[model samples]
Target: MSTERRAPLDRKRVADTALKLLNEVGLEGLTLRAIAKELDVKAPALYWHFKDKQALLDEMATEMYRRMVASAALDPADSWQERMLKANRGLRAALLSYRDGARVYSGSRFTGTDHAREMESNLRLFTASGFTLAQTVRANSTAYSYTIGFVIEEQGVKPLPGERREGYDVQERARLLAEFPLAAAAGAEIFEDYDRHFEEGLALIVAGVESWTRLG
Candidate 1:
């Protein structure tokens, strides 16, 4: 037999392999066995790293967050509004990067405390800008919820970038709403130009937060 050896299994390697297979098989189709097979190991091998599929998903979301932070050039000098836009935009991009990427991230817990670092920075920014701790938490939570909810629906229509589901055709949607002229006309706004819509919605949220901060 050859003396070559395979790389030892670890949480990051398992999560990374699962993320690759996720794009191919998606969240529903991704299982421990599938990830293990991709890693050239048996299913039981993955169990040592991830107790279950959810555990693997938690790590995957953490990895996605790590990549987002690494790729984003967040500036300390940015205004809270600018920070909100950049952070949410980066989040939306990260969630849209894989098949069911949003789904994979929606409820998964992070396996590490790396997220706390970002949270600390954001809280400090808001507090420095005169927001109370409670206000900072609420503001951050609102924006985070908006980003997650928007991407969940966005991915529902287009599971992956440039790939639309069968029932979400714009013309078909318009036809279905033909009886309601305004609703039919709104189909384009609803389905098309998601990038612009996301930015606009995020801006509205940021504006609201600013107003709330001034009042506080």
Candidate 2:
């Protein structure tokens, strides 16, 4: 009789497993019990690492942030605007990687001080680019808020890539808005090509920040 010996359980192991299961069950269905079942452990085992679901979510968000940082390809030679674009694009990609990923990351706090490093880097970038510390905070916050809000809406329309919810069909939307010609014609723009739309919006934000900085 052969038996399998599982690896020891830890917070990282639990969080990693939870991220995987997130894609399958989504945030709404994900629970400590579900994660424990997937890890082949009891629910109480998770409590030792995470006192509650919110704690688990915080770890999951931190893991997502870590992966985003690892996969980012920020060029040192690029301007601050370019860096903002790259960073926010990476953030959007990270949030869209898993089902309800944005939801998981939206309000969750990090379990560690890992985010501080990136925060410091961004602050330095803006301050060096002639933005006051206050402006730096506002600019970064605006861009970050835009990215998060965009992904939240994007995910709401399509929970997973290549999968959109009902009632979002362009033609159906057009028909529903038939009485309003302009609104009806806008369906395709609103419902399709999120990538292009995101880029355009990000560019606008960068430009706005530049103008705001110059004015100040």
Task: Give the best candidate by lDDT.
Answer: 2
Worst 10 residues of 2 by lDDT: 70-79
Quote the positional error of residue 56 for candidate 2 in Å: 0.4
Instruction: List, residue by residue over 112-158, the lDDT tens digit for candidate 2.
Output: 99888778888887788888899988998899999999999999899
Per-residue C-alpha lDDT of model 1 across residues 68-120, encoded as one tens digit per residue: 99898668898888888889999999999999998999899998898888888
Give each model's whole-structure lDDT: 0.89, 0.90
Q: Model 1 — TM-score against the truth? A: 0.96
**Structural similarity to truth (TM-score) of each candidate:** 0.96, 0.96
What is the Cα-based lDDT of residue 84 in candidate 1?
87
Clash tally for model 2: 0
Q: Which clashing pairs does model 2 show?
A: none
